[model samples]
Target: MSVTAQTGQRDGTDRRAGADDGREAIARRLITGSVKRSYEPIVDLDWDSAPVPGRYFLPPGALSLVGTELWNQMTVEQRIELSRQEMANILSVGIWFENLLNRTLLARLMSADPAAAATHYALTEMGDECRHMVMFGRAIEWSGARPYRMVLADRIVMTLLPHVLRGSLLWVAALIGEEIFDALQREMLEDPELQPLISRLMQVHVAEEARHIGFARDGIMRRKPIRGRWETFVAGHGHALAGVMLRRLFTNPAMYRRAGLDGRATARSARANPHFQDAQVRGFASLAAFLEEAGLMSRVARYGWRRGGFLR
Candidate 1:
């Protein structure tokens, strides 16, 4: 073989070997954790009891629609109602991303080596996400809140998710979505004033998702050196786009309607609310650090993230 062809073959071998090594190690650990400790949402939660009415479903600061003028004007009951609606909306977003993630992992498995450790872990993750979706759906049903559907743009993007959310960049997208929800749930778990059912649900999710996030981080680190300049540029932009989608996923006008407010005006005010913007920045800070460390943060991506209001 010619020099270039020989080099290509070597690179491919290195990737396959690395896949079975580093990626598989992370996967094995995750699978062991899953097998040792996993809970069924149906049996784990006290579904017999309903959430207390007029109580916050989530803490006030964590609600995406808070920090707006409209929020300031709402009565205590309205605020609590909106909190439930907002938490439901967050769970709906989680379901959306979970669906996309499962698709990405399944597509990955089609080409993955059957004996590779990551393959088993990916299967484990898919099962976990299925349970999570059911749990989140139950939470929304319990709250009597409507599940937020993805906007048209987000739906359009889902068409390409199978292809886009793969390879080295796959874990980048995974971390962004996982970490955002993780931060929210972590806060809810620490606050005693939040509703008990919601707290217990979040507690379960946070426990399971910690393993998933570790797998994503390990995958990203394994693939870091494989990306070249052009690949890096594309990955950066892809991460930026994912960030934008995540921010949009957090707030919806329909949530305003559920809260008994004018949808358009309230959403518009939320868009302009500096407090909400700051929250987004803070929510994404650790994700930004990870991207920076992984060499996925480029100037172009930074611009997109800042312009999308996900980063300062």
Candidate 2:
């Protein structure tokens, strides 16, 4: 992966044969995957069943407080309550980002040919995202934790980015939001102690997002435009900055208070917690490597990746 490989991905310069597939092959594969293994979360999960007593909404290891002093100070019940709130918080973030993704996909479709395989798969993915939004909303409600509005930072980022994000940058943004969460959910799905409902929800989400991630990753490799220093700088830093925003999106200051902890102090502790940072970095490793291979990581953006706690 050299500079020329990155910038030369445009229409014609030079690429391994089949440069102009427009991702028809990737799209066709994704469409087949969707047909065989997609989920309708509403029908797949037993939404009416009562939650299992003493089961955790999130796996204990995934909790932000897991390795903190506060975790040791807390009782099992308190930790479970915190996990419940955290689960709701994560669902809320999922809803927020899925809305952005659906909107971006629809906007892109405005110019896409309806007959294209890529276009058909984009529609299929949007359908999955819609189901996911509804699923997350219901799951949040079931958590018994109140949903909160998006944070100021996220609101600002969404407002500013949608006007400019398209093609490779849009897909990169999608990957930033999807990959780690998908990884986290997969791990959660394997946890014997996780609440059954949450596990099922994760199962459905993980299955569908696999296709979405494939689509987005293909889009990035096909369209990563690194020709100009300025364009590369924006794409690199923008992707890194989206990762930073995602970290904040997963937390809500008010969730701590609702969970009976000191909101601000707990937030500070979680931000500085080595356990949480290491966990995120581990989940992010594969995606980072893909971006590095795709030539999306600019020098300064690599700096941002470290500072953003996504590459450490």
Candidate 3:
């Protein structure tokens, strides 16, 4: 018996050997269509663009300890470099998440019983993620910034981890990451300081991302029963990974260097900075509180919330 048959039979579905169901066929077509629709970014985004309104790009009350200190100390050229680094970091994070999402969707599609409707949904999701990566990558290049070097840990996770592990962890991670990104994008879209180019990009990206968040939540629910212990493990590890990723966002060494601060010192300061504490309180803390209220926090906490360095 084929792998699909082995799995499908247990689930009360008859499977044809080496042939996918009508639903899977439709799913593949939908995914291909969406991918084609999103393939125009290379020509769509103008690479020789000027800075959009400064106000729209910068979050309110968001400050890097090094960035703030460097503003007080750095020359104009230095500040520009720092700004580039910050943009690189943003682009890198976006690209990496997209890559992970695609990989996870592929894994889900491959592992799913051939008769399951979810398989088609997973394929469409994979197409969505692929488009996201291309969009973000083009955005970075258009902004005249180089891609950020993947952090060592991120490199390992992206390159060396097994697909099953990466897929599971990323699903949970997406839940948190997408939520924060949605909040940020919503704020940016409403800001008058945003340029037409960025506003348009965010508008498009946000609409697609909203659907992805729902898919992620549903995917997790569907898999949790069969993969509960595994999901829990990923969730625990996800907390630490989330913290590391968050720390990178708030205090990248390259960003500090560009902004005219001692990179190491700036990283240290940002990690211990009062601004971050406030951000945690108002941003992540609120998020955590909400998860707890929803009864999801205990499972997350069990996985590694305390170790992830966000709650404490």
Model 2 misplaced stretches (Cα beyond 4 Å)? 1-17, 224-231
Q: How accurate is candidate 2 locally (lDDT)?
A: 0.81
lDDT of each: 0.81, 0.81, 0.59
Whichever of 1 and 3 has more lDDT, that candidate is 1
Candidate No. with top TM-score: 1
Q: Residue pairs in steric clash, candidate 3?
A: 82-258, 236-303, 236-304
Deviating ranges (above 4 Å) for candidate 3: 1-48, 52-60, 66-69, 73-81, 113-116, 166-170, 222-238, 280-309
Model 2 poorest 10 in a row by lDDT: 11-20
Residue by residue across 168-283, what tens digits does model 1's lDDT show? 57887788768977875776676766888998998899999999998888877776776567767767767766666656566688888888888878777776688778877877
TM-score of model number 3: 0.71
TM per model? Answer: 0.92, 0.90, 0.71
Ranking by lDDT: 1, 2, 3
Candidate 2 residue-wise lDDT, 142-255, digit = tens: 878777787676688766666687756788889877998987787779798899999989888988888889888877776654235655566666765655665665556788
Q: Which stretches of candidate 1 lie over 4 Å from their true place?
A: 1-19
Between 1 and 2, whose TM-score is larger? 1
Q: Which pairs of residues collide in model 1?
A: none
* Ranking of all predicted structures according to TM-score, beginning with the best and ending with the worst: 1, 2, 3
lDDT of 3 at 16: 31
